[model samples]
Target: MRKALTLLGTGLAAALALTACGGGNNASAPSAAATLDPANPTTVTVGATPTPQAKILEFVDQKLAKEAGIDLEIKEFDDYQTPNIALSDGSLDANYFQHLPFLEDQMKTKGYKFEHGAPIHIEPYAGFSAKHKKISEIPDGATIAITNDPGNQPRALKLLESAGLLKDIKDDSSALTLSDEQNPKKLKFEENQPEILLPLVKDPKIDMAIINGNYILDAGLNTDDALVVESVKDSPYGNFLVWRAGEETPAIAKLEELLHSPEVKAYIEKTWPNGDVTPAF
Candidate 1:
């Protein structure tokens, strides 16, 4: 029997309500300056995924934000789409659950005008299997699970390419997709939302699943158990903090500074010592 896992639900209705109130594309413009005095703490509401992104913010809120005159309020989102939607609709001050590739794609396709801070950390993509102990053991025509999002679909396909399961992936990000001709192993792919891939890997029919590192941690799966892991050196998939363009305030800048601070880097290293989550700074 597959073990049950708890997944956080997206705030779709709240986001919709906010969007309907002129908060969608033409939301209220950000305040021209910090509304609060520098000496007073300003509250910044952020949306994030449940695992490392939110966990990292909780650490900063508890250990560092007070001294910086910032009060961090984090709203956790399970699905990848909602955080950006919430940010676009003014339901959040900022969000911190995506990489540059994903961020760029969202901006281009959704017409969201956003800016992001420097990369904070890299959650190395990995492939896990309950049916096979090694990549070599995954036979031809096996069913593999991957994320359906355009930004991450290429990543899953790239991981498969690196493992020698596929070949000749298009260099252009938008053109990449699952191709039987490219897949030498004849591996069948099952696509789902990023959050669902972890649970699907446990299904007896799934031969393997390429999962995001944060999801791997959320499911309490050891990174060491991965049959193959993406190399972190110069990896372009580092996750970072994002906010509305031209809306950045002192409080948001402070939070960005704190995120790249040595303290936060140390905390990430300590918490995920196995290199599942590595500081990009």
Candidate 2:
């Protein structure tokens, strides 16, 4: 049997490791120093977001892990920052929530030694609103809630530009800040933590919010409800599995194999029929 833990709030203190089944003495131990034995089922503790990330892992744990000799344990995180923090501190064997750009930013800024597998899926970024049905409905000088993280803020801004809300955006492959030159409508932006952007958009004062597809799913909001959805065609924002450098084991390899298997791809397509989450492989 597998286990799941929900981590709310920020910081390393909130990222308590969950015990995996059959992990007797090493239940609370980190996988960094564990020995790899191909004959035995390896217990891998992975951190992920609550929606499609954890759900996808749960599917693999229940249906595919045993035959592949992998014992999966999943930890659910509400925020984007904590997973990598947990991984860096040896709290998780791996994580499966971020894309290449976000991972690159984290590694460069924090000096994390990490490696990742191929892109597993894409959670299309989109603009959402509770008060407005379309982008044209947003009035000038309206406040729009978005993620404050540099990794995703540019994505949100690009989505807004596609919707004709912003223009003349110059992204220099670095963390971008919104300026008056890009704000044609003079729309004010309220940047908050990614997890909070959902609820912030619901507020009457906030006009709209650009949120990742997973958060929208977790909140019971339909992807069809989004005012402007990011295109998946040739999109570089595909989420993948990540682990510490040189920590890969046979079990981890098996997990990665199962992750990109036809079963997982079919499962993703079947589960997220609305195209909120699509297989990238």
Candidate 3:
């Protein structure tokens, strides 16, 4: 049987020791002297976004990690930026919330060196709207809201291009200004935090919103409701496990193995059917 998952929220600051199942008097007790032991039981702290990412990690910790001498500590972050920040600062042993494009942008722009594990899964990005029923209905000066995340903004523009509202442009070079010529509708863009895009799109004032897959799932809106969704098979936005460069340890390796384990794949497929979430491995 799977044990209950232990989770730490964003507010948690101090390091907490985690004891493997049946190794301590109380599994939930937090200890400050936690250390890693390759040959024996070890604790690993990972930062992750809630929903599927944290939930998936929780599953691995409960079901497979203990037997492998791995005790997983999951810290949940509400935003995309914090997980990487925590990972880079050594606050977290690893993080499992972002795709490669985002990782590249973080490393290139923020000057952080990190190493990532194998592809874990893809949370399809989608376009949603409250004002327009179809792509053609958008007015000439309509406003479109998108994630301000550097890696995701270009992706949102590409989705707009596919919807027949803009022209195709190279990836990673897109911005609000670049869309002027290709934009037949002369659409305006509002860049904000990814999570904020959901409510903004639902507003009658906003024409469309490009929301991240996990946020969409949390909103309880069906993917079919999206104005347009990215292709699952070819999407490059597969989320994975990432850690500080040159910091990979035995505990990290074991956790990575458990993430790609059959149990996780089955859990993802069963938890989210109809391609709402797809295993990238």
Candidate 4:
């Protein structure tokens, strides 16, 4: 599943690429190092979404676990809220959907603790102009459609800021809302799930959309279609696994290691293709 940014490392593995899953029967499991106990069953239950993270898990789950001598179990959740709660309640071992910033925000609002290691992947917020294929084609004052959710709206506006559609609403703003925008294009903000914005693009009324990678994937739209995209040069939105605070399981370590393994890198290369997603190992 896709997590909002704070819910945390590989360090910046080359700018910022949205990270997650992979596949293989057995190329070879890394030799059990002195670091972990092989005999103890280190099974972890991770929660995720469908494409590319969930799709990624389906690919890597079995081989990575068996190879590591750990049994990895992944649970799928289409909605964003459950996984975090599941992690909190002891219903899950860990979750692999949100980014550090998103998780941190969720923790503050919900009063739960979640953290990650390294930045995993970034699903860039791309500006998709229904009328134009290229940024140059966007006429002045076009009515762009951006998600209206409090958390995601600010993110969408940041993309608008980057696309030169709006001026800085806040200097140190890591997140944004419509109130922050100077409205260069006078774009009408339509708050809704990221997916809804795509269909609106079909209507002549909607000029553009700041679509997230998940919605882009759901719509089968490609990077080439985006008039603008999130600048990952120093982006903070990398997907990571969130374990309960004060509890670090051996399975968590195994899962983390496998995430950065050669298998996952290969999977990231195969799945994202556009180099948008990478295992933050």
Candidate 5:
């Protein structure tokens, strides 16, 4: 099923609600940001979600821009659509909050005119441990758990795929919906809030599970027990910085270059570790 990750509950509803307030109607598609104008370095204001992106941006805000001779100002947004609207209305210079696929869905469904700069980093989704040590440790035909939400469902499946538990991903580069899984591991799914995934990881019957790094951190787990990890080298889910179409100011340009710089890559590796959130340069 072509499911959405963000349409889950009241918070998601409130988030999507913002697009209804502003953005745009079914108008012409927005243009992508062009090459940077080094002559006029602008102060770029960007909105970001916490995890890897926001944390990484702080490093750029601190270091890389000075060398590039640009000032990058970053704003933090918990909700997804607000940044897009801010970008559209000229409230913010740009944003670094979403993946390219999610951005496409947002623009097409909400009639948004958004575009992305260079792809930034990939946060590898991983099967975590609260109880089990390995996939084989998960009892045969045991009910491994996955998130019931559509947005996270595929990632859950992919974790199982890495473990040799889930099978039949027709095309690794494209989306892997549940129906595409010709053979599934003997895994059950949990519809619990993404935040509580760590607690559930302790349940004996729960077997194995998949979780995003932020929630994993929230649950008090780091890179200690990631059984099956997401592959950034050849996977399709690397994240990118999103800006309004044709809105490449000098500051945005500098931020893009900084994001791909050597220092930023090292910062991300140290922050997340073991290619969990690798720099996708």
Candidate 6:
């Protein structure tokens, strides 16, 4: 049986409500002035995935934020799109889940102007399988499941290529396809939302799935279960804190610095050893 992480029902509903509002809210962009006052810090609302992002934010809030006069109110989100939508609409003060490539793609396609802070950590993109123990065992005509978003599809394809499973993937390819020459095994590709991918790949119909690093630990799986994993020496997929292009404040900067502090580094090493989650700082 596949170990799939269960998302909070209410959280998903909230995210849906925010996303469903679309771009109809004509709220003007927030002022560029700092929202935090050192003498009287305000609570900053941030949207993040439940796994390591929210967990890390909790650590900062409990251990460091109070002393530094920073208050964080984390809003848990399961889907990637909803967080950015919330941030753009001023529903969230900030978000801490996406890497640069994903953020850039979202901005270009959706017209969201988001500015990111220093990276927190890198979640190694990995290939997992329920049908096969190893890549060599994959048969012809196998169906591979991967994320469907503009940001992740190409990265997933590149990961497959690295594993010697596919070829000719460009960095910005939005439309994913496979020709006979490019796919020697006659493999078929299926795309899905990131949140449901773990459960979706467990179906007998799917052969392999490429999952984001953030979702791996949450799904009760780790590097040990992945058929193939990305190298962490200098990977480009470090997840970072992001906000409206000009809405970044001192509190946000403090959070970013705390994320790279020695205490957080020690916590990451203790929590996810064996190169599962590498601290990007």
Please write out the lDDT profile of model 2 over residues 139-203, one tens digit for every residue: 99988888877777788888888889888665432123556677868888887878778888779
On TM-score, the stronger of 4 and 5 is: 4
Q: How close is candidate 2 to the true structure, as a TM-score?
A: 0.87
Off by over 4 Å in 4: 1-40, 139-141, 171-181, 279-281
Q: Mind giving the per-residue lDDT tens digits that candidate 4 earns over 98-195?
A: 77556665666566755465555677778876688777666776767766434466677777777777777553343223343476555565555554
lDDT tens per residue, model 1, 1-281? 01112243545533442343211122232333554444778889988887898989999998988888888888887778777777887878999899977877677667778888888999988999989999999899889888877888888787888899888776443222446578777778888777778888789999999999888878888778998899999998999888888785888888888999999999999999999889999
Q: What is the lDDT of every predicted structure here?
A: 0.79, 0.79, 0.75, 0.63, 0.62, 0.75
TM-score of each: 0.86, 0.87, 0.84, 0.77, 0.73, 0.85
Stretches of candidate 5 off by over 4 Å are: 1-41, 67-69, 78-91, 140-152, 170-181, 192-196, 203-205, 217-220, 270-273
Positional deviation of 242 in candidate 3, in angstroms? 0.4
The root-mean-square deviation over C-alpha atoms between each candidate and the true structure, in angstroms, is 5.6, 6.4, 8.6, 9.6, 6.8, 5.6
Task: Compose the digit string of candidate 5's lDDT tens values, residues 1-281.
Answer: 01112223446644654554323322132332554444654567777766766778778867765556566666765445556766676767677766655566566666666666666787766776666777677765565556543445556665676678767643322222345344454444555545456666678777666776655554456665677777677655667776666554555656766787889888887877756577777
TM-score order of candidates, best first?
2, 1, 6, 3, 4, 5
For candidate 6, write residues 166-242 as lDDT tens digits: 77768875434566666777777788777778886588998988888778878888878888887777777888888
Q: What's the distance in Å from true for residue 101, model 1?
A: 0.9
- Candidate 4 CA-lDDT value: 0.63
- Superposed Cα deviation of residue 135, candidate 2 (Å): 1.0
Assess candidate 6 and give its lDDT. 0.75
